[model samples]
Target: MRTYALTVFSQTGEKLLDESFEAPSNEEAKKIGQARLDETGYSEYTHRCVSPEAKLVLFHR
Candidate 1:
């Protein structure tokens, strides 16, 4: 599996998610990120991250 530092920003430009994860692929990384975002109660807001698309990170928290 690959690692990823997941992050998300709310529609209002507020940071709603910040986390690190290890997943096999971008889809899995996104799943992990979305799960965290949902926990923060930003499920209804449009969100994105510094990275346009998920990728495998060599290291993560």
Candidate 2:
């Protein structure tokens, strides 16, 4: 597993939230991030996942 930082961004490009944790893979990290976003009821925004090993790893837009 690796540590990933999840960043939520507004539609206008402002940072909304940041969370860091571990996931087995980038795909799993994205799934977890999307699930987190689903609870927020804000779809207009986008998200990205970053890790020391993966860099700018995942993007859901």
Candidate 3:
């Protein structure tokens, strides 16, 4: 498993959500991150999910 960071930000650059989760792959991390965002109703917010290697698994602006 690898550690992934998921973060969400408001339009004004306010940090909304910053969390870490474990996943077997970057693709899985992206799915988990997107699910979390949907559950939190932040799907339309600026967000990013980064892999342990600092690669972007998912990003939305």
Candidate 4:
């Protein structure tokens, strides 16, 4: 398994949110990010692959 940091960006290109966690693959990482958006009332937020690591992301966006 690997940890990945996801950057959720708004339509205008401004970063809306970010998160990191351990997952079996990048697909799981994306699901983790989607779940976060759903929980935060931003279910429609678009996400992009910023980077991957075994470290936790400090900032939310």
The lDDT leader among the candidates is: 3
lDDT of 4 by residue, 1-61 (tens): 7767766777798877666667776666667766776787766666554336544332243
Q: lDDT score of model 3?
A: 0.94
- Compared with the true structure, model 1 gives a TM-score of 0.51
Of 2 and 3, the candidate ahead on lDDT is 3
lDDT of 1 by residue, 6-57 (tens): 5556556776666666767766666776676668876566554323344332
Q: Can you tell me which runs of candidate 3 are displaced by over 4 Å? A: none
Tens digits of lDDT, candidate 2, 1-61: 8899878888788889888878898778777766777777544478777876767776778
Least accurate stretch of 10 residues (summed lDDT) in model 2?
36-45
Compute the lDDT of residue 35 as modeled in candidate 3.
97
* Tens digit per residue, CA lDDT, model 3, 1-61: 9999999999899999999999999888989999999999999999999999999999999
**TM-score of each candidate?**
0.51, 0.70, 0.96, 0.55
lDDT of the candidates, in the order given: 0.57, 0.77, 0.94, 0.61
Order of quality (lDDT):
3, 2, 4, 1
Instruction: In candidate 3, list every pair of residues with a backbone clash.
Output: none
RMSD in order of candidates:
6.7, 2.1, 0.5, 6.3
